[model samples]
Target chain A: MMVSLARKTLLHEWRRFLPAMLAVSFATLLQLLQAALVLGIFGGAAVYVSDSNADLWVGYPGTQSVDQGRPIDGDIASLLEMNPQIESVEPFYLLDGDWRGGHGTGGVSVFVSGVSTRPGAMMFARVLTPALRARLAYPESVIVDPADLNKLGVQVGDTASVNGHLVRVVGTARGLRALGGADIVTSLQTARMLDPAPSDSGGPTYLVARLRHPAAASSVVADINGHSGFGRYQAWTAPAFARLSVLFWLFNTGAGAGVLFLAVIVFVVGAIITSQALMAAVAASVNEYATLNALGVGKRSLRWVVLEQAFWVGACGVVLASVLAALLIWLAHSNNVPVAMQPSVAAACLGLVMALVAVSGLMAMRSMQRADPATLLR
Target chain B: MPYSNTVIDPNPMLVAENLTKSFTSGQLSTRVLDDLSVEIGAGALTLISGPSGCGKSTLLSILSGLQAPDHGRVLALSESLQAMDAKRVEAFRLHHTGFVFQGFNLFPALTAREQVQLPLQYMRLSAQEITRRADEALAEMGMAHRQHLRPAALSGGEKQRVAIARALAKAPALLFADEPTSALDAANGQIVIDLLHRIARNHGTTVLCVSHDPRLISHADRVLTMEDGRILDDSDRGAR
Candidate 1:
């Protein structure tokens, strides 16, 4: 009955609570979108490793993280393939190259990932259909995300100059989303054409190693690292490398801190708005609460009523936010904004909102405590 | 018949002993009740009358277990109200006490029936029984036709009647009214006073009323007049 009374009272005075509802909804929307965008950036940073078929990766020595390492000798691929636990080691090159837009405008950053022209030798081969995979055989031909066409001012058939070398766009990769700039996948020969002297000639950024025993890949990495003869090189299982990349982007750069700081400010503002609105509602109903106290309702029960009110308000806000977030995710996907709306992020945001409202409820309890039955006698 | 302060009343339903209550706002302090003692009998309408600021409401508040005295104790139906903890006192009030205020004090959002059902909801009664009893109380208050109306839709007298119905719905052993008719017209005040009298006489519920209206004292079975936080006269018209 106490809960029912609380619910009924809130519904009865919903007009008074509308401001609180809007505040909560706005907070939830901003938090969800910001967090989702950050997670999306992290996903984009680690996409090369996460979506790859290789179990182990090799990078230059003192490589603190992925996408930040120098090119290692391409011979490391043959040396890694000599291990009994290793299957095939493929040479891969990733570099940020300057590109001239189709309209001959200023230079724009383009990420060029170079792989073997042979089928099944590239990271994206697994995600591509056989028709698209077969097209990898054509030299100087590269794949780009369709969303990047407008960003690069180039279409599927347009020719663009990369590092002052011309390259042909053959096909589009559906899920090859990038954060800082457009991503292009090309054959090793074409990548060499674009940048003839990348570190040493014929050297690749990393050597991706497939494994005979996938689960034992980390142990193999440890064994390979123990060998001092492999100079200026570090070996890592793919997932560990992905984690390094995510951490590098999250804490090593200002992007993560900037997003997190904005989220915290939003959370605090949301909590204050909600708490003040609820306190106002409680103040308005002080006389009714005092009458309840005089009629023998416990102070504890009265607190529960206020807490329940906050809970319902939070719950309704979250529901509305979820719907709004779903629409935002759809629009982002259609427009290729690269936002990751992980279910775990949504759950965490829900917990945050509940905590915010619960604290507000506790703050509102102070008003209820002052509801003196003696006031009613006056 | 006039009763002396020294005389003990028999078969008392409530008793107050040397209750001293004082209010302080900064340096200014006022003693509302100074060593006051009183006994109220069951199944009667007892009216406490005084001019404004004579401590009538304070005494009512302390006696009804809504406020505590600076010193002294209250015993209602042989239970030590002052000795009990806050939770126990709340339970005691829930089971034994009902209150009506001069302002009606009804939840403006609730209909008359819901206001009457509020107390019964705390009693752990079944929904059917609570509804039945609340409807019965409303009917008895002559508000059967207006049970669906909120306080804003009701007149002052009608709002007071709903407040009375809410008090009566719980079937309390003691009913306390703090100027129940002070906000009404003469006709409505008389109607409320008559209804309170009927409730006390017919249901055997002890009704304690705090008022300054001389017109109301005539309807009381007993009248206690207070001055300077002390009872100056106690007249038992029922005994007469």
Candidate 2:
């Protein structure tokens, strides 16, 4: 019966509740899209780690993200190969490049990732097909993300100069977008040739190893880190390195702090608007409430009616927001905007929206105090 | 000759003694009910009739436990309403009293049947029993055919009838009506007064009504006329 009254009232007075529902919907949409954008942008910081099939990554000690890698000794590859659990070891080169397109576009900063052109190489195995990797075997051949072609002022089969070294765009791949600039993929020889100043004398920035027992990567990483002989570098499971990279960018940067502040603002503004609307709705029905008060209904029962109405409002808003967010995410993807929403992230945003509505309901309960049966006489 | 403030009845259901109530706005205080006393009987329609601001409504409010008098006390069904705490008084009202108002005060969002079922929901009755009692009350008020309509779709007379059904559904020992027919036409008003009279007689419910409508005098079992916060006449018209 309580549920019946709450539902019936909302259905009959939908116009009165539309503003509150819209407020909740707007809040949910903002929170969801903000989270997705944050993840999509920061997730790029660890694309190399996340997109690779490597079981473990060996890099310079204290490396926070893949892009911030400092060259470790090339000898680390042989040490990994010596482990019986390690099936293959490969050198991975990361370098900063300045690009000048053939059309004479201005120099653009780019991160050049050089990997083995082997057919079954672990590096970027998920992102780069075997055919695309084979193209990297040719000297001066490079692959870039299609989305960044306009920024680099180059297309496939066009020639470009990187740090005074001429290179050709052999192919274009998707999912190679970077946080601050475009990503340029090439062979190790090409990366070395493009280097104006060879940091660490042309050594690989990191060494990636494939394990025979992929599930044992954590134990292997622990054992390798415990060895005093391998002090020049650190060993991490691929997932851990990817997570570390994303977290470093998310918490250790100004951009991330700005996003966090914007999220807080959205929450505060949403709460205020929603609560005010709910309060108005309650005030509009005060006479009806007073009548109930005179009919011997308890104040506590009236309070439940308000809260139940809020719950329905929130539920309807969430459903509307979910549908709208899904469409917006699709539109963003079509436009090459970085936006990604995991199931867990979506769930958390929904939980926050409901909590906001609950608080609004509690604030709206104050209006019930005005339901004085004595006033009905006047 | 001036009449006594109290009435003699074999079955008095509500008794008030020297009730004094005042309203203060800023510095001026108007005494709405100054040292008034009355005893209303059960199983009959009792009307408190007076001009505007004559304290008839104030007297009814005190007797119904809707407001507390600044002085003296009210005893309803042998229980002192002034002595009970707020929660206990609410419980007492919930179990033994029902009310109808001039505005009809029905929730616009609910159907006639839903308005009637609302207070019954608070009583924590079973769903089947609630439906049965609500339908019965609506039928009693001749509103059963219109029970599914919302207030906006109903005529003023129909709306008032639904409000009466809402009160009757509780089947309380006491029923209070404050200008229940002011919003209706003369024909509807007569029909309403007749229903109240019949309810008092058939259900043995104490019907206490506060109204200024002189046309309703003949239908009431007793009439108390008031002016300037004092009763000028307490006339027993013998059951019709």
Candidate 3:
């Protein structure tokens, strides 16, 4: 009987709910886009952190994010390896550099990391392209990110210069998008040759160390920094540094805050539009509700009718919203717009629509309780 | 019809004692019913005839449990109407009291059969039971052929008969008709009055009709005449 009643209400009063459904669908699509932006930011952060397989990062003290890493001297790297608690220490250079690929119409700056060929820290991000490895992989070859394909206008056989060092771009792999802009992977030998004062440049901007045992991080840092000569360096755990870097990217500017504020506005407007539609339906059926009450229908049953109508409106709104959200998300993704279609975002949008329905149901209840049965006779 | 089912204990179907009803219009108060007392017995047709402004409709409303009198009591099957709670009165009215309005209160959207079925919705009857009851009521009112017709398709008099069928669909203990004949012409009014008599005799249902028409007085088993909210004369069939 309740189901039949719902069908009658939805069938008869579609105009009352269509606006609300459309509003919710729009909100859902925007929410998906917002989620995609959030996902891309976080996904990119994970890739950047994992690419560096260093167990411990020893940088300047009080550094919240790796983007804010302060430079330390090469003397600290030298004195740190002398400690008995340290298993191994390798100095690595990290910086952002621009590339002119395919005649450099739109210049794309990429993050460059200098690495040693020996098996040590920061080996996980090593680009493994066989063709490039056999040719100029040692000091003459460089790997560019896939993201720079259009911006840099480079192909597989393009040659690019880095800091006055004429280098050939042999292979195209993953790990794009830099702190300022896409990564241009360069060898430590090539980077040192381009950097002229490489020896005096503080023995790699960061000295990464692997703990002999996982639990010995604090003791190792303590033993190394306790030496009077290495007082300038700061040692941080991997998880801590990764978390700091993500926080820096997320909260560094007001970009995330602006998106959240816009999302809230959309949600509020959607809820209002939905409630107005439901309220209009209730008002139109006011006389019928009174007639039903006069026919000796219980207040609980009348209340149930209002709630069931609300359920129908919400259900229709959610279905329409889901389809529209999917379409919009697909359109954005195909157009190369960053939109993460995560399950949580879908669930949240659904929950929001249902919540609007519940609030409108509550509004309809007042009519049910207050409608005088005698009014129909009048 | 079985006598046992139609006549329950042979008591009066409705009793009113010293009934007084007043209405507050704007700032002033007026007495519509003043200590009115009456009894409508089973298997008999009782008519209350009065001129305009005689409180005929008000008395009917009080009798049908639609309105409460200010300082009097009403009873149905010896059950006091004034003392019972509002919900109980409403339930009793729904269960045992059927009302036919002068305006022919048929839902415009419903067909004749559906109109009759409206009064039976509160009852826990099976689909077959409801349909059978609706058909029987319409047939008794001589509206069997018009079962599928909407109120818009029916004449003014035919609409009143449909209203009667809807009221009788519940087989209520007492049928209250407020100016049932006022909305019909002389010939149609006679047909409605004859149907009331047949139902009273054949079904043993009590009939209490409120009307101002002198033509309706001839068919009544008993007539109570009122003037200016006062009963001026009470007479039987010969004195009618």
Task: Name the better of 1 and 2 by DockQ.
Answer: 2
lDDT of 2 by residue, A1-378 (tens): 442777888898999889989999999999898888888899999999878899999999999888999888887777788889999999998989999996666999999998899889988888899999999999999999999999999989999899988999999888899989999999989888888789755689989999999999999999888876654899999999998998899988876788779877877777787778778877888888888888788888898888998999999999999999999989998888988878998999999899989988898888899988888885
Better of 1 and 2 by TM-score: 2
Error of 1 at A109 (Å): 3.4
- Who wins the TM-score comparison? 2
Candidate 3 residues A1-378, lDDT tens each? 111444556675566667866776676666666766765565455344556666677877786676555557867766667766667777666665556665646556566666555643353344534443344346667776666666667777777665655777777766444444566666667756655345444466677777678577766666655666555677776666776776566666666687678777877787677667766766666654544444444566667767777777778767776777678778866665545555766687677667767776777677665555443321
Model 1: how far residue A225 lies from native, Å: 6.1
For candidate 2 chain A, the 10 contiguous residues with the lowest summed lDDT are A1-10
lDDT of 2: 0.88
DockQ for every model, please: 0.50, 0.60, 0.16
List where candidate 1 sits over 4 angstroms from the true fold: A1-3, A50-56, A61-64, A73-89, A117-122, A125-127, A150-153, A193-195, A198-203, A209-240, B1-9
What ranking of all candidate models by DockQ puts the best one first?
A: 2, 1, 3
Q: Which is superior by TM-score, 1 or 3? A: 1
Please state the Cα-based DockQ of model 2 relative to the true two-chain complex: 0.60
Pairs with backbone N, CA or C atoms under 3 Å apart (clashes), candidate 3: A36-A340, A110-A182, A177-A182, A178-A181
- Of the candidates numbered 2 and 3, which has the greater DockQ value? 2
lDDT of 1 by residue, A240-355 (tens): 89878887888877887897788788778888888888888888888778877888888888888889889988889888988998899789878777788768888988788788
Worst 10 residues of 2 chain B by lDDT: B1-10
For model 3, the stretches where C-alpha displacement exceeds 4 angstroms are: A1-3, A20-95, A98-272, B1-10, B17-26, B30-33, B42-240
Please state the Cα-based DockQ of model 3 relative to the true two-chain complex.
0.16
Tell me which residue pairs clash in candidate 2.
none
By lDDT, rank the candidates, best first.
Answer: 2, 1, 3
